[model samples]
Target: MSADLTHVDTWLFDLDNTLYPVESGFMKQAEARMTQFVAKTTGLPMDEAYELQKTYFRDYGLTLHGLMEHHGVDPDEYHAIFHDISLDALAHDTDLLAALQRLPGRRLIFTNADDRHAERVLERLGLSALFDDVFHIGSFGFLPKPDPAAFDRMVEAHGMAPAATAFFEDSERNLEPAAGLGMTTVLVGAHAQDSHASFVHHRTDKLAPFLATARLKEAA
Candidate 1:
């Protein structure tokens, strides 16, 4: 917000941890499901499955991508199992909702998650109607973020000018590609300060308050 974001006309947000606080335990549920899928598919023990899941995430940016590349897992099957998470721990974030409503211009979700998961998460957070579009993993043909190609596809598909866009993400690595494409990159979550990466234009442990500080552009 203090970084001269007045030129931003398109807001691209990552779902999951970016929208809801990680402390909410919602992602823990999805991660547990991911471990279960890995165990059942690969016949690995629960403990080892958890480790492999983490490795896949570390290497591929998405566990599903690693599974598809190494195990030939079907994308649809993986998505269905991995995202069948309970939202009991997620509370409605009225502050985030208000901030998004205040921001003028196109608002879109750019997530590694599939559309179904994205929609459900937004609906749970009372932000379902606020977004103009969702560019999910399917939209990128299973290529997820941190990959420069994914950023290019999103920009091309949405007809957005990277310089006029601002992307918010929870992962510091993911913001690197956005910055490379000339977009304003804001890192959200507890580890935001841990990153000394020059690519991160802004950092905030709390997204709603950071967004609240955003200055609107005046009419020409």
Candidate 2:
């Protein structure tokens, strides 16, 4: 709606599944890398490592955060191993990139993944230059999202007014705090149906349609 765009001067997008569809198979490879990393780091069996990684992701907002807090794992080492997997499984979506370019105002990436991974993915999509900035888990003292502190730091670092920014993420849980901060929230991809995102302001299965709607609202 027009009301939504009135307060949104900046657009924050999530990387990974939010940028492209999950069907691309990039996530599958990434997940495999994460599982292997967990297995090697924890010295657990592959199956157990997978379960533990999932548990950490479920308990802590991110597996890396949980690994760091409880397992004493090195963040940089973990990130390097976990996110260094091949991105060849991902396909380019030029239409999405074009749609994003047409949107008005500053656009940035706010991802839970480390900056290195974000850069690689964006570059693969031909969208590396489209973003005004990239904020990653490493940006704010390694604190991952769903933590209000991370969002606050992002606001301060970018000199963004809470009411003038819109955050788009695939994870529903991450949207609530941003919404609480007074930013317009857009939940992207299939996870938009997740119950954790009940407070999100908008939901879209694809980025193009959402950007189109936002542009229309801005015009109105």
Best by TM-score: 1
Between which residue pairs do clashes occur in model 1? none
Please give the lDDT score at residue 55 for candidate 1: 96
Highest lDDT among the candidates is held by which one?
Answer: 1
- C-alpha-based local distance difference test score of model 1: 0.89
Show where candidate 2 strays beyond 4 Å: 1-6, 82-84, 191-197, 216-220
Candidate 2 TM-score to native: 0.91
lDDT at position 214, candidate 2: 58
Tens digits of per-residue lDDT for model 1, 1-220 = 2556788889999998999988898888888889999999999999999999999899989999999999999999988875667778877888988888878789999999998998888888889899999999999989878888999999999999999899999999999999999999999999898889999999999998888777866431
| lDDT tens per residue, model 2, 3-101 | 246556688988988898876878888788889888988899999999999999988788898889888999888878755577787777777877777
